[model samples]
Target: MNQTSTECVRVDINVFPTAPPPPPPVVGPIPEKLLKIMRKYKYNWRLDQLSKPKHLEKKFIAEVVEPLKIVKVKLPKLDPEKEYYADQQSIPLIRWLVINKKLYGKQNGKKYRKTINRYINKGWGSIYNFYKKRERDRRLRQRKREAKKEKRMPDFERFTKLAIPKRLFKPQSPTKKSPAKIFSNFDRLDVLATPKPFVEEPVKRLGVNPAALTYEPTETVIRLAQIPARLKNLPKPLEPGKVQKSALRYKVTPRIETLAVPKQRNEKAKVDEDYDPWTIPPNVLKYKATPRILELAKPTERS
Candidate 1:
């Protein structure tokens, strides 16, 4: 009603209360028991003066910060064949989100999606590139090992030279003269001229009749009957006279008393006129009768 007269008066009405800045947003003191628990569990938390905070900042730090700090993270190994990635560069970012579960929430659920995005934007962009390079290097080493294994395989040429053919193992034939050539000189003449068959003829001195004896004719009798042409032409012996014996006995008879007289001894006596001349046969003189000389003689003269 007093301003009804249109008089301008500046009255400051504070929409947000400036009552001593709301007593500087009262900070609850950390309990000694909770601090001890945090010290024991938080492995990565800095206890240095530069990182320690005098008062907690609600905007920057969570109201009930988890006591545990993750010192290490373990990601599940990727099955490169199955996972769908935008490119090889996205591999490590995915690995980081999976492993650092505390940084991003448990199970990589929606609550931690924003944290993942923030890490990707920040200097963590090169993580995937580094992982891809390592994967490529490992694959190269594996390929090199496979190449070395192939090189070490046995060479076919080496084995082929060592292998021998079955035909080469056959035994060698003996070197000897043929049977036909050894008996070439044998003939029928050699068979016929061998030796006369020996025949045992019985003597009948007791005036026994020859017909009365049991007589067996031998091969010698048959062979002798077939006389050679050369021997058949030879002359027979002359017959002796019985009457000449009486005439000769009377003519040559000297008185026994006169013949008994001492005769002069001669060292070389000539001959008696009545003695017959000794004639040597031609075959007997030419033939070699000794057994040793016959054995060493030529084959034609052997028998």
Candidate 2:
């Protein structure tokens, strides 16, 4: 008897991905709500990547980064029958473990390392050169644009003079006034009397001003005929927004000197009659507390 056997062939297509496709970043403009936060962090960058710390791995953590889910660890079965700690056995931990995260994986680390090394080697200088190159390119582009604009423009003055309307350029005869009569009809302005200026009288809190007593009415000061003319001798009515020249002088009235007071002492010592401290008093008045009177009452101890 002949037996039939079937041979099976397994074709495993090894689809070793070149690199796992990067996650879609939640990139956006610095949101209006985040403007104050950006200013506080001094991260005033306009790029979409600068504000996305999770995907971009830029400087500090940003709001775009989502917090990791807490992991719960179950407690060991110390007492299986007890139900008191049943609900509380599994503890949820909210902590940041500094282990190798997805961000530090082999594929993403190369770029981060490259940038870090670049920054370490030359931080400010590289940024400066990049901006300088951009500015130079911008200036070159502007020059080219201006040159193109100039080439496109026609010579303005080369064209024929604009057709000016007759009403615009036509000259008209000016009205000439008749010659004035030279005879002295009105008094000459030069011959008019010059009115005296009203001088301001100094204000006194108590005594009346001496200059006000001899005051004369003038055109500059307002004259209130109803009241005594002497009362109007005060300073001229100031123009609405104008301040008096004296007001700007800031003269602090010298504070009146205070009256002198009798000398007083804060000690119980009485004022004794004058006596020379150097002169020795007679035996009756000699001080008893001298070195001889200060002898030690106890026997002196020897070291």
Off by over 4 Å in 2: 1-128, 155-303
lDDT of 2 by residue, 1-303 (tens): 336876778998877757444435438765777777655754334344555666645586666868899999997766754554453333221121112223463566777656544443342234334576677679999999999998999667655445444465768789899999788745665556666689999865667778998998786465544678767687655466788778899655545222234335434423554534456648847756666657754456532
- lDDT per model vs. reference: 0.64, 0.57
Alpha-carbon shift of residue 266 in model 1 (angstroms): 99
Residue pairs clashing in model 2 are none
Off by over 4 Å in 1: 1-126, 155-303
lDDT tens digits, residue span 1-303, model 1:
675678677999869854221113227997898678566854323333446778987786658867888688788977775453434444345556646756547566975777666755442345445666678679999999999987998778877977856565668798887677455656767997899899998874767677767677789988887979998787655345545545667754478768878766353433555433365757989986788887777465321
- The number of the candidate with the highest TM-score is 2
Ten-residue region with minimum lDDT total, candidate 2: 91-100
Question: In each prediction, how many residue pairs overlap at the backbone (N, C-alpha, C within less than 3 A)?
Answer: 0, 0
Candidate 1 Cα lDDT to native: 0.64
